[model samples]
Target: MKVVIAIDSFKGSVTSLEGSAAIAAGIRSVYPDAEIISLPVADGGEGTVEALVTASGGRFVSLEVTGPLGQPVAAAYGLLGDGRTAVIEVAAVCGLPLVPEAARNPLHTTTFGVGEMIAGAMRQGVRDFIIGLGGSSTNDAGTGMLQALGYRFLDKDGQDVGRGGAALLDIHSIDAAGALTGLQACRFRIACDVDNPLYGPEGAASIFAPQKGADEEAVRLLDRGLRQWATAAADLTGSDIASVPGAGAAGGLGAAFVGLLGGTLESGIGVALEMIELDRHLEGAQLVITGEGKLDGQTSRGKVPYGVAQLARKRDIPVIALAGSVDHGAEALNDHGITAYFPIVNGPMSLEDAMDPAGTRYRLQATASQLLRLLRAAGRL
Candidate 1:
């Protein structure tokens, strides 16, 4: 029997690799001769860098970079085993969690640290980049990041416009003359899932700014600034960035990557699965196991389990998902390629106890063993 285990991290509890090991151990208890392939996976959000790096035998590079509020923050990026590929999660630098609720205004946040991270990786001879655009606290449309990369956003008087969403409205021109020379030789693959535009009613500010600490008035101001920035960027790059799908993700940082950095935006899970080469490992697997911390309506939207199921479905393999908690909408996953879904919790317990790493591992192992026992009795193992 062959089994492929690819589970995502359980947030504060078990990690992807750890969860996979637990599942594998359970399977081994039932079928000791089973060939188990464990792969670490993430949804291209917070744990992206760690998952990809650990799975690919990569190293992490940590540095102090400017935070969203112009203060110093410790940040890190991943250098893959390939020696040339660097994976960066925007959340690691300017994510909302890094800012307190009282200080979470998008107008004052910046992505300068994201650019600094890229520059730092470039200095290490990394030319290929996989950037995850999620959990950002800025609505600067990448101006702050662009500024750090040498693309100057200037006021009408030709002075530097400075950082944050507040600076977007003051921009009169964009100067690419001083931009990093090596940027032309680099290739960027952006992991993005949202499709909001750059500005307007359905755009970045209007849709996502409120959660980043913007009120109605701040949303209006940020939207106006985004519009102005989009126009200036169009004048410079000659591309209508405002209309691009996912151009509004991560508080308009997606626009900077796709419009200014010449990066291509793709589904976050698709990018993650491609990096891990999930298909290659699924070749002759009889059973595939995948899951995450939770399974809900959002799981079908470019998440780890959904991505794995789709690939397994192509090969006619039975895919089972194991999550810490299963919500009402998780049943919808059955139509999307998941053969079955199971929750690891055995009985009623506190949420904290359920999330305990050792407890999660034990429950996962027990569940897998029982599932395998059922399959064996049914002559399906």
Candidate 2:
């Protein structure tokens, strides 16, 4: 029997590789001579770069770039084994975690560092990009990132506007004469999980700015600013992206790429899986195992387990999902092709105790052994 393990990182507990290894050990205990392929997986969010880099035998390139608050911060991206494809998580440069809770104001943050990262990668001869647009700390309608790429956001005085989302209120026109020429030769694929509009009740400011430290009043102000930016951007690019799904993701970074850069926004997990060639690895696999830190209704929405199970279903392979805990909506996972799911926690224990790496490994192995034994008795193995 051949088994393929493609599990995601257990947040705060283990990396994707670590989780996969623990589960692989479990499967090995049951099927000593079975061929096993362990693949680390992610859904283009927190652990995307590291997971892809590790799975593809790629190298990471780190550099100092401007942070959300205009301070220098270190960031990293991955150069996959293909040598030309670079995976960059936009959050690494200007994510919410980089700023303290007291300083998490979206009005003043910028995605300039993300543009700088892309430019740096371009200089290194990278022609393709996989940009993960989650966990951003900015709401500038991607103006800061555009500025870094040589697109000038001008005010009425023909002078450049300041950085941050608030400055978008003064944006009058865009001077793209100096826009980066390298962009014409590059292809960008943005990974996005949300489908909010650019500016409205369910748009960027209304839906996400609060979490980024905006008050009720600030949300109104930011919404107006986004409206002004969208107007100017549409006038310049001839694209009305304000109502586009996912345009409000990452504080309107999605709109900027779609409207200005002609980038394609797609499912985060699907993009990551395609990059790692998960389909190629699943060929002839008898069983597939995938999971994450939590399994719930949310997991059915472009998450790693859902994505992996979708792939396995196409090949008529059974998928078993493993997680640290299971929530109310976990039963819904069955509709997404998960044959069954198991929570690794053995018994009543504190969250801290269940997350211990050693204990997690032990439980995963024991669970896998028992699962296989049951399958064997049912003549399904």
Candidate 3:
């Protein structure tokens, strides 16, 4: 019997790798020699670095960089075993978690830390890169990151615009003279999943600005800044990135990567699957297991489990999911090659108790055991 445990992180409580390990324990209890393969996954959001490392034979390089609120923070980027490809998650530097609740505003956040992460990797002989743009705390339209990389944004006085989206509106022109020269010699891929443009009603400000603590009026100010910055980026790079697809991802960090860094935006799950060699793992497997923190209507979108399940279908492998909570639309998961879906909770428990650190592992183990038993009978293993 062959079973593969492929699950994303439980989020806030456990890691995807750790969750797979716990699930492996239960599978072992059922079939001591079940030939189980553990493949931890992430959707290019949090825990993406570890996911790439576990998925591919990737190495880590750490450095000191600016955090969300302009504070110094230690961050790391990854290099796959191929030795040439770099995997960088911007959240490692300028994510919402680093900024305190009272200080989480788009007006002041910057992607300079993200730029520093890339710059640090470029020094290590790394060339090709897969940048994961998610969970950002800024709405700077890529100006901060471009400034860090040598595309100088100057105010009317011809002086540097310091940092943040507020400064973008003061720019009269941009100078790409001092940016990282090596970027011109390498291939860059940005992993993002949004289609919002850089400005306007459904653009970066109106859609994502509020999440970064921008009030109604603040969102308007941020939107105004993006329009000016977008024009400047076009003049500097000669690329129309403002209205581009996914330009609004990570508060316009995706646009920065595409416009300033000369990178192309790609799907995060597509990148993860290729690096992990999931197609290779799916061959001849009797069953595949995948899940995330939750399964609902959104699961039909580009979530990790859904993408993995799609791959499983091509190989005629049945998929089973174990989620933190299963919603009404979960039954639809079966249409995507998932033979069955199940929730991890045992009966009804308080949302807090279900999320307790002590209870998560036990519940996951029990859930996996029950799932294995059902698969055993139906799978004829």
Candidate 4:
């Protein structure tokens, strides 16, 4: 049996890679001779670089950089096996994890560390960049990153604007000529999964800012600042990036990547698939196992599982998903090439108990056994 296992991270419990491994173990139990190709995937959110690196045989490069709150911290990005392409997760440098809950306000966070990571890689003579935009703590318009790279966000006094989203209000003009020299040889691809615009009711600040500890008032201020920043960026780069789809990702860092780094925005799942050449490998595969932490209406909106389902659909492969939880109904997944959905839970349990993690490996293995049993009865195993 040439079975392909591709699953997203289980979040808070197991990584996608770990989940795939457990599933593979169970598959082996059911059919020891089955040739299973396990590929743990991330949807351009957290853990993306590591997943791609593992699948592509890439190496990791660790570095120290400023965190969301200006404290120095150590973080790492990935180098594809070729050592030419760099995979960066902005969250590694400026994510919510790096900051305490008390300091979680978006107005205070910054993406400067992300730029520092890029600059560090560039100094090492690596240029290709794949930026993952998810799980962010900042609502800045990526102005912090621009400043780190060479764009001077100077105020009227010629002093540099301070860090955080509030600084965007002081952004008069962009002096990108000298700032981004390090990335001159770099090509950029930004992995984003949202379609929100840069500024407005459905934009970055209004939709995402509150999640990062922004109060209602803070969201309003951030929204105005983003609009102004967008206007300035357009005047400088001739791209109305603020209104662009997915530009609101990661607190408008998506806009910075596109406008300044000239990065192409794509679904996180699509980026990983292209990076790993998954489509080419999927040829003639009879079945595809794909999943994520939770499945629901959101899955219909271009999540990783949906991306995998799309590929399986094109190949007419039967696709089944195993997730930690199933939200809403399984009917929605059917349209995306998923034959059925399987939740890892076997009994009623608290959210904490389900995410115990210590017991996750066993739970996953047991679940997979059931999956095969059901499939076998259907004469498809």
List all candidate RMSDs to the true structure.
1.1, 1.1, 1.4, 1.5
Encode model 4's per-residue lDDT on 1-381: one tens digit a residue. 778888888889998888888888888888888888888788898889889999889889998998999999999999888888889998889988888998889888999998888888888788898999988999898887877887887776777788898888877777676776657668999999898999999999999999899999899999998988888788888989898899999999999988878888988888898887778778767678888888988887777788888887888888888888888865688977888888888899899999987677788888887788778889986
What is the C-alpha lDDT profile of model 2 across 1-381, one tens digit per residue?
999999888998888888888778877788889899988888989899988888789999999999999999999999998899999998899999999999988989999999899899999999899999989899999999999999999998999999998898898888888988889888889999999999999999999999999999889989999999999888997889898999999999999998998899999999889878899999999899999999988999889999999999999999999999999998998998999999988799998898898888778778888888888789998
Quote the lDDT for 381 in model 4. 63
Which residue pairs collide in model 3, if any?
149-179, 150-179
Runs of candidate 4 with Cα error greater than 4 angstroms are: none
After superposition, candidate 1 runs with Cα above 4 Å error:
none
**TM per prediction:** 0.98, 0.98, 0.96, 0.96
TM-score result, candidate 2: 0.98
Name the lDDT of candidate 1. Answer: 0.92
Better of 2 and 3 by TM-score: 2
Q: What ranking of all candidate models by lDDT puts the best one first?
A: 1, 2, 4, 3
lDDT of predicted model 3: 0.83
Model 3: per-residue Cα lDDT over 89-143, one tens digit each: 8888898888899998889999888777777778888788888888888898777
On lDDT, the stronger of 1 and 4 is 1
Structure candidate 4, residue pairs in collision: 9-16, 149-179, 150-179
Output the lDDT of residue 147, model 2. Answer: 93
